[model samples]
Target: MPTPIPPGSANETALLDLLRRHPRVLLTGPPGSGKTTLVHRVATRLADQGQACHCLAADPGLPGFGPPGAICLGRWDPRLDEGGGWRLETIEALATLDSARFRLPLVEAVRRLAARTEAGPLLIDAPGVERGIGGAELLAALVNASHAGAVVRLAPENAPDPYAQERVALGLEVLKLPAAPEARHPGHQLRTQRRTEAWDTYLTEAVEQSLDLVDLAIVGTPPPHDVTAAWHRRQAGLLDATGRTLAMGEVLALEGGRLKLLAPPLGDTPRTLVIRDAMRHSEGHLGTARPYRAPYPATPDEPSLRLPLQEAVDGPRPTLRLDGVRATLVNGVFGDPLLHLRLRHRKRSLLFDLGDPGRLPARLAHQVSDVFISHAHFDHIGGFLWLLRSRIGDYTPCRVYGPPGLAGHLDGLMRGILWDRVEEKAPRFEVFELHDERLAHYRLVAGQPMKALSPREVDDGVLHVEPGFRVRAVTLDHGTPVLAFAFEPDVEVKVRKERLDAHGWAPGPWLGELKQHVHAGVDETVIELPDGSQRTVAELAQHLLLSQPGKRLVYATDFGDTPDNRERLLRLARGAEVLFCEASFREDQAEQARRTGHLTARGCGEIAAAAAVGQLVPFHFSRRHVDDVGELYEEIRRHFPRLAATPGSDPYSEVD
Candidate 1:
C-alpha cells in the first residue's frame, strides 16, 4: 500500500490547488483506495474556505451520500457540519449494478449539474471499475460525458494506470495521489451490509402511504400494465415530474389499481415510481426477495390452448425451439411483434424485430447483437432507441438488417438525439439495407452522422452468413416493401460417442476441427488420435460422424395476402421447422386485413400449409380482436393442423 497523503502537508496543499483550478473533477481509483474519503475531505476544505462545492455520487453499488442503486447530487454546507454529513438532496435510481442501463441518463444529469452557474466546483465520485475492457470503456465514457478537466487517481505505488490512453486522447490533466492509510477492500457481504445501512438511514422518517396507481406512472421494472394481481414486495424510488427523488420506499401491496408503499412522508404527490430490485424487510435488515411469478390462466374460450403468449407480458421466455436455438416473443401475440432467438452455444442473441425492446431485462437486452427489421413501422422499429440505450457503453457493434430505405430511417433517428457528450467508446450500429439484388451498408456512431459504405451484391438473396448459419431475405408487399427472413443453419455433424469410446478417444478441440473440416467438405486431411495413431479425414468421418440437416426458422410479418407475396413467402418458408407468420385479422374481418396490407387468419394458415412447414406459430394479431383471439387460432388450425401454442402457453397452472 502507498503512504497516505498526510493532512495539512505540502502534498495535500498541491492536491487542493489542483482541484480548485478545475470546475469539474473526477475522483477515481480501485476499490479500497479511499476515493470517497478524499472526495469528502476536498469538499470539506472547499466549504471551509466559504466556497460552495457540489458532490455527485455516481456509484450505485457503494454510494457514499445516497441510497443504494442510485446516483445522488448534494451540496456541502459547512454551517450544518458537526462531524456528521448532510443527506443527499437529489437522487436518481437509474439502475442497480449495470452501468449500461444508466449511462446516457447519467451523462445528461452531470451536464445539467455542471451547467448550473450558481454552483461551485463539481466533485464526481466515479465507480471503482479501473480494470478490464468494460471498466476502461465505462471510465472513458464517463470522462467524456462529464467533460471533467482533471482526474484525481488514488492507488498504491507501482500500480498500472488504466486510463493512460484516454488521458492523452481526451487531453485531460491527470493528478496522482496516494491511497488513504485506513482504506480497506470491501467484500460482497460488506458491500451489501453497507447498502442495507444506507437504505435504513434513508427511511428513518418514512411512513406508510397509499396512492392510486392510475394517477402515477411506473418506471423501471414495472409490473404488467394490463394484468391485475398481487405482486411480491419490491423496493422503489418515488420521483416527481422533474426527475427528483421524492422518497425511497418498499411496495407493500398493489390491489384495485392502488399501490401501498412505506416511505418518508411526502409533501408533494409523486408522479412516478421507479422500481428497483425485488427486496423485503427481515427483522431490521433489507434483504433480497424471491422473484414474483404469475399464475397461468387458460383462455375462457379454449381449455386446451393457453392465452396468446402470456409470458411476453412478464418477460421473454423460451417458448419454442428450432434445434438448439430458443425462441421468444418480446411482446405477446396481441402486443408488438418482436421475435428473440437465443443462439445455440453463443453468448449473443438475435432479434427478428425491434418492437418494444424495453420488454427485455437489462442483461438480456445487452446480449442482442443482430436485429432484423421486417418493416419500418413504429411498432417494428420504435424500440431501436431503447436497444441503443442498453448497448451504449458496450464494445460489440449491433448489426441491423432491414428493407430498402432502412439506412435513411435509422440515420434520421440517430441524428435526432444530441450526441455532443458521446465519446468514441460509445455504441456503434451497422445497418444493412436489403435492395432488389444487393445490400447497402451504413455505419452509425454516437456524436457523428451516419456514413454509407460500399454495397455488396446479394447472392441468391442471402443477406448474412456465419460459421454455422446464413440469413436470407425476400421482399414482400405491405403497402410498403417488407422483408421476410429465413434463418438456415448448415448441415450438423455430430460425432458418434459409441465409436469414440470404442476407439479410446476423448472429446477435445480436435473433434471441433474435424467437424469444421467435414462442414467445409474436406476429406483428405489426416486426423491424429490421442494414442498417436493417424487416419484420413474420410476414414475418420465415416467411423465417427453422423450428418443431418439443421433446423430452419422463417419469420414473415405485415405482408398483404396477395399472389406475389404468398409466392415469395412460400419460397422462403418451405420446409422450415417453424414459421412465425402474422395473422392480423380473422376471416370475418378479411376486408380490414386487406385494407391494412395484412393477412387474415385463414390466409396465414393457407400459406403455412402451402409451405409444408412443420409448425405454424401466428403472432402480430390485430388489437381489435384481442377479446376473441381464440377464434383466430381455431381458424388457423382449420388449414394447418400442426399449429403450436404460444410460448409460455402450456397448461401448467403456476410459473416455476
Candidate 2:
C-alpha cells in the first residue's frame, strides 16, 4: 500500500491519502520520532470526514506514549502500574523481568485489540524501536503480530534507516517521514517536567470513579493495592459495553474503592475499565501524549543549565517620559519587562506587566500605587510574587486590574506562601477582571484572605475611574486573556505661560487657583488676583488657563495582530497620545507570531496607524533577535514610515 503522487497540501492531507489506501498502517520510528503524532493526526483528520479511525498503541513501555483515547493492548511502563509511579522500588522490580515474558503477552493483547478496531481504519503507534539493548526482539514481535499494511518511519532527512528496509523486506510498504526542527526534544528532564504539567492540567478537572473491589478478582495482585492500578496510572483504557475503547484515562489519585481518573469525554458510563499494571486495555483520550524530543549533542549526564535571578536581569533602561508620564523600563528591552510609569509632579504612579519586580528600584516600587496586568505569561507576569511580597507592610491599597481569571491565578501564585503565619499585612489588593460587558471585582485585605467583591456592570469598557483619569480596557488575542488599557486623563488644563508673564506675578498661587477654577467649569467662580483685583473663572480661562482634550496614553502588548482584536484595540487606543505595543517578532515570522499569539514589528505599526496614535513606541522584542532589533524596526518602518527608522530612536514629543 503506497500513497499516490500526493496533492501538495498540509501534512494532514498527505497522511490521510496514505491512510485511505492502507487501512492498517504501522508508524514505526525511534523514540521522539513523531510517529505517535502522525498517527493521531491521521486519525483526527479521518474522524472529521465521518471516517472513524482507531489508534492502537503497539505497546506502551513508556509512561507518556498513549495519546488520550488511544488503545494500548500491551503492558505499559512499570513506573505507572498498580504501584504508582511514586513507588520506585516496585517499578524497579517489574523492570527486571525477562524479555520473553514481557514480549509474549503483547502478541495476544494485539490480537485481542485488533478484533475491536475492525469497524474503522487502524493507526498503529509502534513503540520501542531500538532505544535500548535487547529491545529488537520486542520490536520484531510487535511488528510481526500487528500485520500492518504499511510502515512509516519518521526520522531525519537522508538519515540511514534499518527498520525501513527490514519492514519493506517483510512485504510492508514503507514511507520515510522526516522530523520537524521544532520537534527536537528538549531533554528527558524537560520532558518529564512537561509531562508533569500535562498530568496536572488533566487531573485538575478529574472526577472520582468508584471501583468495586470485587471487579478486580481477576487481576490477583494483593490486598491494599490493585495490580491494575499500575497500568491504569500509566495509561487507563476506558471501554464501552461492546469493549470498544471510549477514551484513555490518566490515573491521578487512587484511594480505597475510588479511582480519580482524568480521561477525555466517554459520553456514557464506561462498561469496562482497563488499567495496565498487569492488565491490557481491550479498547480510548483526544490529546495524545506530547511527542518526545530528539536527542542533541549534550549528554544526559551533564548538569542542566538553570536560569537564576541574575541571569534574567538585563539592567536598566535610559529614562524617557511621554507626556509627563516618566517611563523607564525596569528591565531592559530584551529582558523580562517591568515597565515603571509615574506622572511627573503628580502622586499617581503605576507598574505595567510586573516582570522582574525584584530588580525594580526600591524608590519606584514604593511609588507604584497601581499595577496594570497584560496577561499571565511567565515572562509577562512572573515577578508579581516579588511585588506582592515587597508590598507586604504597605497599608495603602495597591490595586491590581487585569482580564478575567486573574483572581484565581493570583491565588495559585500565592499557594506556596504561608499566609497564616505571616505577621505583616500584604498589600491591600483590589483585583478587577475586565470583560466586554462588565468588570468582575474582588478584594484582598492587607492581612485577610482574598475574597470576591460585587460585580459592577459597565456600559463601556471603563474598568477603573479615578478623579484625575479613567482606564478603559479591551481584551487582546494573547494565548491567555490580556487586557489592553487606555488611561484617559480628564480634560487637561494648564496655566498660560505668556499670560502669567504678562501679569508679572512670578507664577504663584493665583495660577494654580485659576487652573482649578477652569477645570471645575465654574463660570461664576471668582479668583482674587494680585494687586487686590478679582477675575471671573470664565475670564481667567480665556486669559490665563489653556484647556484641551485630555491625553490618552494607551498600553497594549504581548498580543496577536488578528482582525477581531485589531478592531477592539483600535477602539481602545483611538487617538492615543502615546501607544506602547509589542513587537515580539519581525514580519518574516508573522505567521509564527500569529500562531504564538504574539505580534510582529509591522503588527505594532499597523495597530499604531489604525489607532491614529500620536506616538508609536514598540518594545518587547523576542530574545531570538537580540543582536539585531534593526530587522524589527525595519519592517515596522515599512508599514509605519512615520515610526523611528531605528530601535530606541523615537522623535515623537508630548502632544500639547
Candidate 3:
C-alpha cells in the first residue's frame, strides 16, 4: 500500500502525479514557496502507502523533518542502514557535495541509491533561495540523475513560484527532450519609462561609445553582434586546424585551454562557434545571446574508439593490465620525474609518466591511451607540453594524477604555452588533484573534474575492493612521500589439475568460471568438461578438490633500509616470484647510495635475501652506472644469490 497523495492546493496533486511518473525530482522555487514542505509531505504519503521513500534535505544544519520510517542522515551517518527504509541526509552525505565551495555531490548519491533501491524513487530537495548556487546545481543534478537511469520530474508553474518556467525549459534542453509550450507568468509585467525619447538617446550613445577595443577592454565587450563576428571567425579557423591534427573522440583545449573535454557526444562534428564561456570563464555578456555550435570533432573513428561503460551507473574502474603478462612494465626516462608503465592489453600501449615526450617513440604515438602521469615533478611532467602540442595519438586525452598541485600545474602549463589552441587542438590533458579527506570515495573523472566517483570509502584507503581482489598501498621512503602498491587475489586453489582430470573433469575457460562460482559459495555449480562431461562443485569438493592461492606481486622502490621499512618490504615481497627493487647504485657505490637514501644493487639483494623472496630484479639505476649495468647485476647476485640474470628489454618497444 502507498500513502495517499498530499493534497492542499491543485498544484500539489499535479506535482505528486509528476513525482509518481518520474522517480527523480528537483523542486525549486523562491524561499518560503513550500518546496521543502511539499517534498516532506509527498515522502510521508509514500511511506504511509508502504513504499520506500526518502526525502533528503540539501542542508546539513536543518533539523529532522520527523522519524524511523525516515531517518535523518548527516555527516554522523553517511551509510544508509542495511534495512528497507528511507533515510534523510544533507546533500554531502547523500551525494559528494561541497556546498560552501559550490561543488555538487549528486552523482555519488544517485549511484548509491540506485544500487540500493533497484530503481526505486528518490527525491532531492535543493536549496531553493541560493539561486546562484542552487539554480545551476539543481539543473546539473537533474541532468546527471536522468543520465544515470532515473526518470526526472519538475514543476513549471510561474505565478507563485520563481524560476520554475526557466528551470523546466532548461531541464528539457539538457535532457534533449521535446519542450512543452509553457503557460505565461500571470503577474509578470514589463516596466515602462516615462521619458522614452530621452532613454533611446542615452542607449544610442552608450552603444556607440562601447564599440571600441580599448573601451571594451576597460568596460568589457558586448554580446553577439556584427562586431563580435571576427572573434567567432578566428575561433572557427583554429578548430579547423585542430581537426586536421587530431582525431574524433579525443579531448581538446576549450575556453582558452583551461578545460578538458572527456569525450564528445556522438554525431557532432568539429566546427567552432563563438559563445559565452561557462562558469570557469568570465561572463561575456548579460541579457544577450551568442553563437554556439558543436565545434568538437565528430568522426566515424570516434565512436569505435570510445571505451564501453559498464551497465551499472558507477562506471567501471579498469586497472592497467599487460594481457599476456600478469605484470605490465613501467618504462621511459626522458619525461619528468614520473615513471612510465606501458600497458600491453589494448590496441594502444599507454605510457604513464610526466615528461617531455618529443615525437613519441614511434610505438607510443599511434596508441590511443598514452601519457597517464603519476605526479607533478617537472622531471616527471615537463615532457607533457611537447606531447600536447604535437597533436599525436589523434589528440586523445592524456590522463594525469598527482597530489594537490596537479590542476594548477596543468593550468599554468597550458596558459604559459598555448591557451588559444583550444579552438585548434582540443585540450588533451585532464588533471585530478586528490583530496581524500574531503571526498572519501570521490575521484574526479578523467574529463569531468566537477563530478566525483560514487564508491564509498570503507577504510582510509584509495584503492577500492574489487569482486575477487584487493589493492593496498604503503608509503615508500622517497625523501618525498611516495607509495608502492600490491594486488592480492582472494581466490584459493584447492585441487590440483591432475587430480581434477583424473576425476574425468575437462579443462576450459568455463572450468575456471565454475571454480569461481563454487568458491563464491554457489552450491550447485555444474561444470561441463571438454568431452561433454558434467559434474557438480559438491562432487569435486567431496573428492577433496579445491583451489590454490592466487599469485602475489609487489613493487617497491625509492626506499632505504630502515628496520620498519625493511620489515614492510619483507612481508610484502615474501615468496613473490618476482621482486622489483630500486638499484640506484652498485656495491662499490654504497656510500653514494646511503647518502642519497636510495638502494644500491647490493642493498636490494640483501633485502631480497632477508625477505626470502624467490627472485630479485633491480631497476631505477643511476645514469652513471649505465655502462656497468651487467656488472652491477652480477654484484647484486653475489649477495642475494637468487637475482635473475635475464637481459631486460625496453618494455615500451611497440615491435614486441
Candidate 4:
C-alpha cells in the first residue's frame, strides 16, 4: 500500500513509464499552490492541440463538472447535491468514528467517483485530511479495489501531518501482511514518496497569467498629462531633423550665434526651446499651437552656429522684431484728397488708401482684411483704383465698410472712365454697404453681386471678431456721415493675489494663462495652482476681485456745435490713454466750424481737456489754413496745454 502520486512529477513520470499506461492522477498541494487551476490548464492545452479530453470535477454541490458532450467540462460548483446517494468520505471524514452503517456514504461516493469513465486518465484535486486522520489507509483501500493502476505519491509543501503519516504507515503494513482483500480491480498499484514537484508546474502557469503586456499606440489610448514633455522626448529627433530645435509655441530671435525663444519657461523646462545652429528667419512662427516642420537638413553643408540673441524685458509678451508697422501722413490740414496707411502684422504688411494712382508699392498690393473709411469723399479713398488692380494669388479676401452708398460708390470707382486704357485684369473687390436699417450691412461683390447680413447697425458700438482686435466705431459728422474706428487688443490682465500668496508664488507665465482663463469665461479657464490643484476663472476672479483692473481706449471725430453730442464724446474719451479727434478748423472760424459740423484745432483741445485724456492726436483737418497749422496748434495749446503736436511737426499732416 502506497500513497497515490500527483501528476506532472518526475517520480510519477518514471512510474507511469514502468506501468506502460495512463494512471488515475490525483494532484494535491498546499492552499495557494493552485492544484485545481493546474488541472484545467493541462486539459485545455491538450484539447486545443486537437487531443479530445473529457474533464470533470465531482462536487457534491454539483452532480458532476458542467455541461455534457464537450471535450472539456466548463465549470462546476460542487455544493449542490444532485443524487440522493450516500455521502462519501475518507478516514478524515470519520474523525468522530461513527457506526459502520455511516461509512456506507463514504464508500458510495468513492464508488461513484471511481465509476466515472475510466476511458481516459482522471485528474483529481485531493482534499486534505483533518488532524490525526488516516487518509493514506482509506486511499490505499480505494486504489486497490478501484483499478487505479500505478499509484503515484505526492508530498505536502509544508511538514507532513504526523498523524496522517502514522496512519499511512499502518495501512502499508496491513496491506503487505498478505491478509489484504483480493482487489478485483484491474491493474491496481500503490506508491508513496516525498515528492512535491507538481506544485511548481501550477505556480509557473499562474505567474505567466498574472504578467501580460499590451500595446497602447492605438486610438483609444488615454492622453498623457505631460504632453509637452512627451512630444519633446518622442517627437524631437523625428521632427527636428535639421538638428535645430525651434520652439513650436513661441517666436525666436537669432543674432550673432545666440538663439532666443520668445516665450518664457513653464514649470521648470523652458516653454520655448532654441537650437544654437538653427538658421533663422524674420518671421519665425505665428498663431497658437502650430506644429513645427524642420526646413533644414541635419547635416547642412555649412553649419554656422547661428543662435538667438537675448534681450531683457519686463512684459509677458515682447516685440522681438519690427516689420512694417509704419505710419505716414500726406495732408493734416486743408481738404486734400490724399492719404496713406501702412499696418504690419506677423504675416504681412498692408498699405491702405494710398493716394498714389500710378504704379503701386509692393506693400500696398498685399491683401487687406479691413478698410476703415473716414468718409466717402474722394481724398480718403483715392487709392481705390490701385487697390482694385493689384490683386494677386491667394490673397485673403478684403472688406471695406463705409457710409450708406458704399456699394454704388465703389462700383462707380472701379468702373471709372480711366480704366479703359488699363491692360490687366481688375482686382476682385468686395464692398459692404452700411445702411441705417436693421439689416444694415450687405455685401456687394464686383458691383452687381449682393448678399445681405444680419442687421447690426449702431452709431457707437464694438465690432467683435476672433483672432484680431475689437473695433469701437464712433460716428463723426465730417460733412457727410463719417465713422472712425478704434482697435483694441483682446488681452486683459487679471490678478489672483490671494491664490498666489497662498502658494508663495512669483510672477511668471502662469499669470498669462490666468489672464487668458479670465477672459475665456469660467468654463474655458483652467487655473493651475502651485499645489498641483486648479481653480476655474470664476473662482480666481471672485477670490481677488480688488487686484484686477480693466483698461479702455476711445476714438472720437467729426463733431458739430451739438453740445450734447460733444459731451457724450468727452465722457467716452475720459481717462483713455490715447484719443484721436478731428481738427478741421481754427478757433476764429467757430461759426464756419459750427456750420460745417466738424471739430477745429481749438475744439479738439477743448474736448481733450474736458475728457481728461492722457494724449490727444488731431487728424482730418481742413486745408483752409494748411500753412497756418502752427497758428491752429497755438490756439489749441493756449487753452489745453496737454494737447501737443505729435513729437515733431504733425503725425496726421497727410490726412488732408
Candidate 5:
C-alpha cells in the first residue's frame, strides 16, 4: 500500500504488473491532489513497457491526457481533433443529462468508448475533490459501466466518493491513495500568471503560418454549436506531425479549407497537422465558464465566478496547531479573506468559517462536527457547496451556525444542482441563524426543495452550550450580517494530591467523581474512597479541589470598525487567550477599509488591545499588500509590541 511509484522514480514495473490484471484504473483526488498527473505518469510508464495504454479524461476541463484517440469527455474543441483524442461525450449523454434516467446514457457512452478502444488498459481520470458528491457519483457510474478493475485514489480515506461505503458491494479493489509530494497550490494570481506565461510563451515572436485543414480532424465531441465557428473563434495550438505543440496561433482565415494563422516565428513550417482549440484556464479568470460534466454547471456563456484558495495544495506545511487547535488561513495570508479555526478539544472537532475549505485536507474534513460562518460573502463562504457535498450521505449530522439567512443560503446552494436521483439519502443539515440577542434553528435533509424556516425564538444569546464549554455570538457591521464567535471553556477543577495524601486517603476514580460533583456544586453528593469510606462531595472537595479559569478564543473578521461594534467586540472578546482578527488594510488605506466594511491593522490592534487578549494573530490582508503583509503586521505590532518574546517586558505592554 505504500506508493506503487516510489519517490524519485517514475519506474512503472510495479504499476505495469498491476495493470495487466486491472483493465480500468480510475484515479481521483482533491484539487491539485495530482490525480491527473498520476494518470499521465502511470500511462507513460505503461507505454514505455510496450503495453497499449489509453487514459480517459472523465473530467472535461482536462483532456488529451493520453496519446491521440484517448477517451475524453466535455470541452470538445474542433482544432484538437487531429490529435486523435476520442470524444467520450455523446449527444445522447448531453441531452439526457440529469434526467430521471441519468445513469443510462452515461453508461452507454462509457460502453461505446470501451468498445472502440483497440489499445491497452484504460485509466479513467476523475475530477478530485476533498468532498465532491456529484463528481463521486459520476465516477462511480463510469467505473461500473467501464468495468474498472481497480481505483487508485490520490487522497486519504475521507476524500470525496459517491460509492465510498458501497465499494465492497461493487467488487472494486480500492488501492491505497498517496499524496503527491510535488503538489502545491500556486495561488490565484500566481496560477493565473503561470497560465498567462504559457500563453505568452506560445504567442512570442511573429509569423504567418499556413495550416492545411483538408486532412484535419477534431479531438472532442462536437458541441451543439456550429463546428466551423467553434474552430474559427477559439485560441489554438499548432501541432507538428509528431503531435508536439509547435506554437500557439490565432485563426485568421479558414476559407477554402486553407487555414491562415499568426504565431511565433519558426524556421520552417514542418507540416502543421492540427490546431488544438482549448486553452487551459487559471482559477482567477473570474467569470469564465468551466464546463466540466455535472448536475451543477454554469453554461458555456454563463459567467459564474468561483474563487478557491488552497493551503496544502502549495506544499507540505509546518503544523499550524496552537493550544490544542489548528488555526489555518483558508486563503493565503495575503490572498483571499478566509480563516479556518479547527478546535480539537478531546475527540470533538469544531470549525470556524466556510471560506475556501476546498483546500482543507480530506482527513480533517471528516472530523468536523460543526462549522461557524462569519458572513455570507463569496470570499468567506465560497467553499460552502464543496463542504456540503463532501458530507453528502453522511449519517453524522453537522451543525452550521451563522448570521441571518444561513439556512436560506444553504437551501439555495443545494437547489442549484439536480438531485432528483439521490434525494432520499442526503446529509442532515442543522442550521442555526443568529438574530440580535436571539437564535433560530432549522434542520434540512438534501434532495427536497427547502422552505423558509421561521427560526424558533431562543432569547438567550448563546449559540452552543457543550458540557465543558459554551459559544456566544454577536453580529457586526460587515455591510451584511457578520457574526463573531467566542468559545468559553468551563473552569477546571484540579484535585490536590498533596492534600489527599495528607488526609491519608489514596487517590482513585472517586476523585474524578468528586471533581465532577464539585464543579456541579452538589453538596449532598457522596462518594467512596479507595478504603470504601464515604464522604460528602462538598467536604471531600473542600480540601482536594483547586479551580482555574479555562481558556477562551475569539475569531473576528470582515467587519467595519464602528465605535459601537468595537465596544461590543471588546466586551465579548474580553480576557481571550487568543484573538484571530482581520487586518485587511493598513493605516494608509483606512478609508478604503472602512468603505469595504473591513478593518486596518491599526484598528485590529486597537480592538485586540481593548479586548485585552493574550495574543493577536492578524490576517485577511488586502491583495494590494500582497507584496508584503509584514508591513501591516509591523503597524499592528507598534500598538501591541512584540512583548511576548521580549526580555523583561514592561507591564505597560499589558493592554487594559
Candidate 6:
C-alpha cells in the first residue's frame, strides 16, 4: 500500500490543486476517518479563495447538513456569510434514504445534480462502508453516476487502504490523506443522542396539519393496508414535484380518508409523502416504533388489450425482457428507429441503431459499449454527439459496426467538432465497416485524426463474437445498402440448486468447472473439489446441471418491400424469438413504402409469418397515420397473429 501524506496545511493545498484539475471530487473513508472534517476544511479554503462549493451529504446514518434518513444537497458560498466562515447554507433534502432499497435512486439523484450548471466545485461526502462487497458496489455506482474525476481517501494511522482496488478499477485519480487527530468512533448511545438532537433542531417550529389523502401520492413505503389496526407512527418526508423536501414529520393518524401529520408549517401542499422507517416521538424525544409486518395484498394484473396506434404511440414506454437481454424502443413507433438492448448481468449494452438518442437517460447512454448502424441517415445518426457527450469521461471504447463507407462518414462527423481543450480521458470509438466479406477497422479519439487499421476477412456473415454471444450482419438494398443484424447467444447451462441441495453439496468454484466441462462436451473428465476430493464430471452434470437453448433477436429496418430484401431478411431472422421490423406505411400504400425504401404493414407481417418468428414488433410508423393508425395494426394482425399490440407490451411473454 502507498503511504498517505501526513496531516498538515500542505494537504489542503494538494486538495485544492486536485480540485482545479477535477471539479467534482468524492470524499470516502471508514468510520472515524474524519471525512466530514476534511470536507469542511476544503469548503473553508475554497470560500477563503472567493469560490463557492456545493456539498452533497450522502450518509443517511450520520447527521450532517440534513437529519438522519435523508440525503441532502447544500452549498457554501463566500458571499453568503459576512464573516467569511465556513457554513453550508441553503440545504435541501434530495431524497428520503434507505440503505438497502434506495441505492439506485440515490445514484440517480447524484447524476441529476452533477448535470446541473452550478458555479462551483461539488464535493460528495460518501457513507463509511468501505470494506465489504456491498460497500464496493455502492461506491462504484456512486462514482459512475456522480461524474466524479477524483476521490480523496482518509484513513487512520497504519490502516490498510480500503479503496485501492476500486481506484485502479475505475481509473480515478486518488489522493490519500491521514485522519484528523480528534477523529474518534462514536458509540451506539452517542449516535442515537446525536440523531435525537438533530431531529429536535429540525422540528423546533412544529405544527399540526390535516391533509386529504386523495391529492397526495405516497412514495418510499406505503401505509399498512389494514385500516382497522391501531394507528401507528412512521417517519415521513413531504416533497414537491422536484424532489425537494418540504418538511419532515411523523404520521400521527390515518383515518377518515385523511392523514394527520406533526411537522413544521408548510408553505404549500406537498405533492408526495415519503414514508420512511417506523419512528415515534415521546416526551420531546424521538425513538423507534413497532414494525409493521402484515403483508399487503397483491395487485391484480390488468387484462391485455390491443390499443389504437395513436394511443399506443403516445402512451407510456415499455421495456421487454427476453431470456438474457432487455429491449426498449428509443422513441416509440412514430419517431425514429432505435432499439436499445441491454444484456442481463453483463453491466453493458448495445444500440441497434444510432437514431436520435436525446431521449435516453445519461446512465443508459454511458452503458452503451457497442453500436450497430443500419445506414447513415440524419435521423439514424443525429444523436451521436449526445452519446459522445455523455461518455466524455468514460474510458471504455465504444465499438460501432455498420455497412460500407461508415468509417468515412464517422471521420467527417468527428472532424467537424473542435477538440482544442479535450484531454486524453475523452471517450474513444472503434469503427468497423463491413464490405464484401471484409471488415475494415478505424480508431477515433478526440484531438486526433482517425487511424485506419488492417482489414480482416469474415466468413458466414459473423461480424463480431464474444464469449457468450455473437452478432451476425447481412446487407439489404434500401436505395442504399442497409445492414440487418441478428444477436445469437450460445447454449446456456445452469446449476440446479435443488438437486445440489438434495445431494448435501455446497456450491463453490467447482460449479464453474462443471459448466465448462458440460459446455465443452467433456463430461467424462474428472473434477477436483476444494476439499482435496475428486468427482466425475458426468456424475456432477447428471445431478446438478440443466441445459437450455438460447434465444435470438433480430433487428431489420428501413428496407424496401422487394423480393431480394425479403429473402435476405428472412434468412437472418428465421426462428428468432423477437423480430423488430419496420412498418412505415399502410397496406394500401405499398407504392409509397417502396418509394421511400421502407416496408408496409402488410409486408412486415407477411415476412414475419414466412420467417416463422415467434413475435413481430412493428415500429417506425409514418406520421400520416397518427389519426388512423389502427388500420396498420389490423393489417398486420390479419397476417401475423403474434404481433405485439404496443411497443411497451412484452412480446416474448405472448409466445410463451
Tens-digit per-residue lDDT, 73-190, candidate 6:
7777555446433343423342233443457666665666556537568888887766446677878888987788898887776878756888779898988887776565553334
Evaluation by TM-score, superior candidate among 1 and 6 = 6
What is candidate 3's TM-score against the reference?
A: 0.37
Model 2, which residues run further than 4 Å from truth? 1-324, 419-424, 502-543, 644-656
User: How accurate locally, in lDDT, is each candidate?
Assistant: 0.74, 0.59, 0.42, 0.40, 0.57, 0.72
Q: Which candidate is the best by lDDT?
A: 1
lDDT of 1 by residue, 1-656 (tens): 98875653443565678877887888788877877877777777776777777788877766787776677787877666584364467766653444434456555555554454244687788887764566666677777766778888788667788777876676778888877544645544345567778877777888889989887888765657454432434677788887776777877778777888788888788998877443544444444432344533445866656533234343223268654466776576767788888764344688998887755665566677889999999999998888877776746788999998998888788888887666776669899998899899999887687899999999988999977789999999999999999999897667788999898875654676577677667899997766668888899999999889988999999999999999999989999998999999989898998898999999999999999999888888887765566788889988998876645422111110
Cα RMSD to the true fold for all candidates: 13.2, 29.5, 23.8, 33.1, 18.4, 14.2
In order of TM-score, best first, we have 6, 1, 2, 5, 4, 3
Best by TM-score: 6
Q: Return the TM-score for each candidate structure.
A: 0.53, 0.46, 0.37, 0.38, 0.46, 0.57
Q: List the residue pairs that clash in candidate 6.
A: none
* Model 4 lDDT, full chain set: 0.40
Worst 10 residues of 4 by lDDT: 185-194
User: Backbone clashes per model, in order?
Assistant: 1, 19, 38, 27, 8, 0
Q: Candidate 4, residues 254-344: lDDT per residue as tens digits?
A: 2332322222121222222221111112322110111222221112332221111211110000111112233333332233323333333
- Model 1: how far residue 65 lies from native, Å: 36
540-575 in candidate 5: lDDT tens per residue?
A: 767678778867878888899899789878888988
